[model samples]
Target: MADIGAAIATRMDVLPITRTHRRATVAVGLGLFFEFYEVFLAGVLSSVLVKEFALSKAALPPLLASTFVGMFLGALLLGRLADRFGRRGAFLLNLGFYSVFSLLGAFSPNAVMLLVTRFFAGLGLGAEPPLADTYLTDLLPARHRGRFIALAYTLAFCGVPVVGFLAKGITEGKILGIPGWRWMFVLGALGAVVVFALRRGLPESPRWLQAVGRTEEADRVVAAFEAEAGITEQKPAAAAPVNEPAVPPRALLRPPYRRRTGMMVVFHLLQTFGYYGFGTLVPLVLTAKGYPVSQSLLFTAVTYLGYPLGSALSLPVVERFERKFLVIGTGLAMAVFGIAFGYSGSMALVLVFGFLYTATSNVFSNAFHIYQAEIFPTSVRSTAASGTYSLSRLATAAMPFVLVPLLEGAGPNWLFVTVAAAMVVVAVDVAALGPRTTGRALEAVNTDGAPVTAPERAPRQ
Candidate 1:
């Protein structure tokens, strides 16, 4: 077992993340950014769409909810496809699906058409995050996995500012006689073109190769990575031990991993309620509070800065602490700060609270992505993450329609208070049940009764 672990780690470590890998990372990152851009643009363009289509506030939720419904189906369906087919094949097909639908979204003539297009676009978007997370995690060395994952998320969020800035600029100044709001979908489609081009050069993940019984192809891919990194002597592949029982997904519901998955799902559920509630409804909330469009966009931009800022500050801590503890601590902090945010009237206080809330919440966000993917075996990693992540999306999709009514009836403070309380519950669950996965190998962190060692650090490149 020790030798097997070492061999896997060595294989992961020796593979150089060369220029090609870097480009692959960038392509995948850009793909994620565009996915987010499509989702978030609705927040920026809500009022415009509402007015242009002569729709009421009640109409907004269903439009947004449709996307997540599609995403749920996509993740479940496409995730299984990735598992059965291959990562590269699944990724290319999904990207093409997204690109075509996004472009068509720009041509939607009515609310119904737009909603349908967005839903399909979301299906394509849904597959990318978990797929990208799985692909990137498999490609990088274990020691650098956390940082690389952080970088991917950071770059993925670059779309927040880009969407905000573009929406602000174009909406404020109409371009090419086209409605600025429509350009959001148009530009998102254009971005997909870049993703498509770069993806053509990406090699298949070596880990995926090994899983599908293509051992020679896996060796060559790993060897290429090793050669790029200048590591000549390769570690011998581990012989399969006799009578090793196949670990089923049901095992994840047993001892160590059961607790881990439950904690993660609960944490994500609460966080999604808060995050999607606040994030998706920002423009509507701001408009209700009497902020102008430009100011709303500006404030949204300022608030989202917290995501990247939080990611940067939390990277060091992520490496130091057990992922479960980090999630609990950050989640508790977010709950406290979120309440303060709900009560504050001053704009400066709101922005301050927003920044702090985003920072703390994202620490949990970044950690969980790495933690969840690590907890499962490679055979079902994408399935687990995608399926689990889709639950958060489902929660988020429901929030706008369900929570918005409560906010309107009871007021913003009550709405936030409810969300904060949920966060508190999540924090407790995670603290009690979450497993330690700070420095662990992906293969050894299984729920099955495999006697595993503490994950070792990968050699620095």
Candidate 2:
């Protein structure tokens, strides 16, 4: 099994980018697209719902927090299925789970029902990203792993702007007498279905197969990739001795992993304040500043263009810089831009800083997502990543209850000041404790789930 696993890892690590790789990345990315669509939709859709549902200020927090709460449960519960079973099956199951409940949410008659459905939808949505991070890290070659992962998320983040613009238009009018916000739910459900179909052909992670002692399947899958890359004519290289023994999930709390796990937990806990904290509150902040709902949603749509654009911009630099430095630099940038955004009175300054703030967030986002998955071993990659990721969900889930009151009482500047402080904590946490993963193979990063000694650094551009 060790030999087989080593062989599988070697073949995958050395292969050039190929059509097979792109197909798999796209399949995973499409699911992420819809997951984020539903997640971000809450902010815009909830703003309209405050009026449409005749929601009391008291009811608003529960409605907004429902999705993240469900996600919290989903990541904690369902995320392990990928590591315990296989990545491909979990991929299909999660999307199907989210689509059904989200469709039901479109027809929800009252706040309670909508909240319930969104929670269930979130259960499925929560696991999608951690699963994506695990699967992409397992599948992509180390040579340009960060670049390809960014490409996957570049496609994924497009969902953010799509939801924003769709909300801009859809919230204004009815489609077939169904309220526009409800239509957003219907559209997310439908798009997820399409991605479900598109993902049916995605191959299981070969590394996972080898890890679970399914060596024959692992070989066949790697062989197919080798053929696709037109490298089958060459002799197989001697397998390196695999040190990646099956480490139990509990190992994350012991020794070398304890520090890594602690770093990620703090990072996830604080980072959301910078990312989703700002994202979810932007419309409300604009509204507080006296922009009407229409203008708020419009400005949100324009600023959100940064999500995909920032992800695209990261592709060139993601591979060039060390992941930890990228994460640290972007966190500081988000704090600066977020403060600028909060202080701006002019519409022009608001748009410019809002766009910059959002763009920097995505770069921050891309760097950390890639960083998280790479830090763990294959046996517990999904478990560890999802476990930490669940913390982010929990933070975002509680964000409305905490930040909403702050926004109301302290004003947008102080609201942003809170977010900036959190980002600073994230920068410090990652800088002090995060490991170097740039271009290193997983086995080298964490040997037998223990901390690895310094490995060769990725060559600089």
TM-score of each: 0.91, 0.96
Query: Which candidate number has the best TM-score?
Result: 2
Query: How much does each candidate deviate from the true structure in C-alpha RMSD?
Result: 3.2, 3.0
lDDT of 2: 0.88
> Where does candidate 1 clash, by residue pair?
none
User: What is the lDDT, from 0 to 100, of the residue 312 in candidate 2?
Assistant: 95
lDDT of 1 by residue, 321-421 (tens): 77778877887787788778777687898789877887777787778777777766666677777777778777877887777897788777777788788
Superposed model 2: Cα runs more than 4 Å off = 233-242, 448-461
Per-residue C-alpha lDDT of model 2 across residues 1-461, encoded as one tens digit per residue: 57667767877777777798999889888888998898899897767999888999889999999999999889987778889999888888889999999999989999999999999999988888889999999988876789988988999999999999999987888888877888888889999999899888888899888888888999899888887877745444433434566788898999879999999999989999999998888899999999989999999999999999999999999888999999999999999999999999989999999999989899989999999999988989999999999999999999999999999999999999999999999999999998888877787787744333222222211
Candidate 2 vs. true structure, TM-score:
0.96
**Alpha-carbon lDDT, every model:** 0.73, 0.88
